[model samples]
Target: MNDSFTLGFGGGGFEAALRNWEPIISQTISFVPTLEGGLKGGMNQREIDRGVDGFKQLIESYFSNVALSENRFTRAVRFK
Candidate 1:
């Protein structure tokens, strides 16, 4: 359980998003590992980085909506 949590944290920018979230920012990114993390039964750093790139596309594509994602495994917040 602890390992899963740690990997999730390592996989995504869960902490960074929180910092980005503020009244002024009105934006945040969320990335956490959960059941999906168990999809492959586990994940590695390289795979995680690759996954993050996918999310970055969302931020690049959608500017105003922010990087808010419906994904359970990950979410992203964008800031200027």
Candidate 2:
């Protein structure tokens, strides 16, 4: 039986988010190695870094889209 949790976050504010989620993050890191398959099941540092990078990219894109929309909205309001 495997009993462990994984923690991760996305977006441009990872540092800030980590500060708020330190406890949960610590728990997950501590638990991961104790899983049934251990690091061999892809729970190693490389995999975790890859996942975090992917999530960061996704979040950056999302924020970029939001910024574009906000800019357009502001432009429209000024022209109106």
Candidate 3:
């Protein structure tokens, strides 16, 4: 479980790094679970923040100079 989370964070961070490599990418990062999970139609404030936090921490912790985004990178149209 821990390994997976670490790998997941690293993978998402890599994506974030790619996204910020050029201006063509959007400022808002398309995050993973926490983001997609929080964005569901009925989620409350805490629920939303929890999801955003997962990806946000990855960017903020390692890429402090980059833009901070509250969004997630989901391949599906509806994450929920």
Candidate 4:
């Protein structure tokens, strides 16, 4: 019974890790464009708008991922 519980918990944790990686992966992918936008000048309206959109998206995506990852990791650690 104890072994079964341990295995179940471990499996769940592993599954969660796999599930959680996607947003992080996505944000990582999104990072390059965001950084590029930051590094370059945005003197024009369109360029400035692009930079703002990029920043907003990055922050939204990243913070959401952060919240989810933190919750999951915390729960996992607490479970253990």
Candidate 5:
């Protein structure tokens, strides 16, 4: 699991890497509940849904920052 998370974080460059992080995190979170009673005996639907929603917010914030950084870089290059 750690390896998978690390790979997802460093796999693709920039945009691609950010995109990959979403699913990897989601899958990892979803799997946690299954360790007790197989595939269908863990966390409730509400908990899973909340986890997914939280992930979406985190991804959005990351992408927003990436976009802002890219815009600043572009502006700097243009001014130079």
Candidate 6:
């Protein structure tokens, strides 16, 4: 849950895109630990990082449509 969220634009302007997705990024981060099975599950930082990376890829690559939607914003926010 200590990871940072960063949306990078290759060349075009994407500030709005970044802003639009902030909530999704925050929510994702908040729920990660709970979804990881908690302390008893013996999850380590590396595993958490991997999970974060996977989530990031999932959001950036496939969830663009959901990310763009106004209704499902909270679930999309990842944390930092």
Candidate 5 residue runs with Cα over 4 Å from true position? 1-41, 67-80
Score candidate 4 by lDDT. Answer: 0.57
Off by over 4 Å in 4: 1-42, 68-80
Better of 2 and 4 by TM-score: 4
**Model 5 per-residue lDDT at 23:** 48
TM-score of each: 0.30, 0.34, 0.36, 0.35, 0.34, 0.32
List the candidate numbers ranked by lDDT, top first.
4, 6, 3, 5, 2, 1
Best by lDDT: 4
**TM-score of candidate 3 to 2 decimals:** 0.36
Candidate 6 local lDDT, residue 46: 70
Candidate 3: tens digits of C-alpha lDDT, residues 1-80: 22433333224465564553444134434445447777677987887888777876865664455432323322211212
- Which candidate ranks first by TM-score, i.e. highest? 3
Of 1 and 3, which scores higher on TM-score? 3
For model 6, give the 10-residue run with minimal summed lDDT: 3-12
Candidates' lDDT values, in order?
Answer: 0.42, 0.46, 0.49, 0.57, 0.47, 0.53
Residue 10 Cα positional deviation in candidate 4, in Å, after optimal superposition:
36
Better of 2 and 3 by TM-score: 3
lDDT of 2 at 30: 43
Clashes of each: 4, 0, 5, 0, 0, 13
| Poorest lDDT segment (10 consecutive residues) of candidate 3 | 71-80
- Against the true structure, candidate 1 reaches a TM-score of 0.30
Candidate 5 lDDT over 1-80, as tens digits, reads: 22443332333357755464454456445434434332243766765666656656655665476634554333322211
TM-score of 2: 0.34
lDDT of 1 by residue, 42-76 (tens): 67666666666665554455543533343332333
lDDT digits (tens) for residues 1-80 of candidate 4? 22544432224567676675555566566565654554456466666667778867776776576745666534443332
lDDT of 1: 0.42
Any runs in candidate 6 off by more than 4 Å, and if so which? 1-41, 63-80
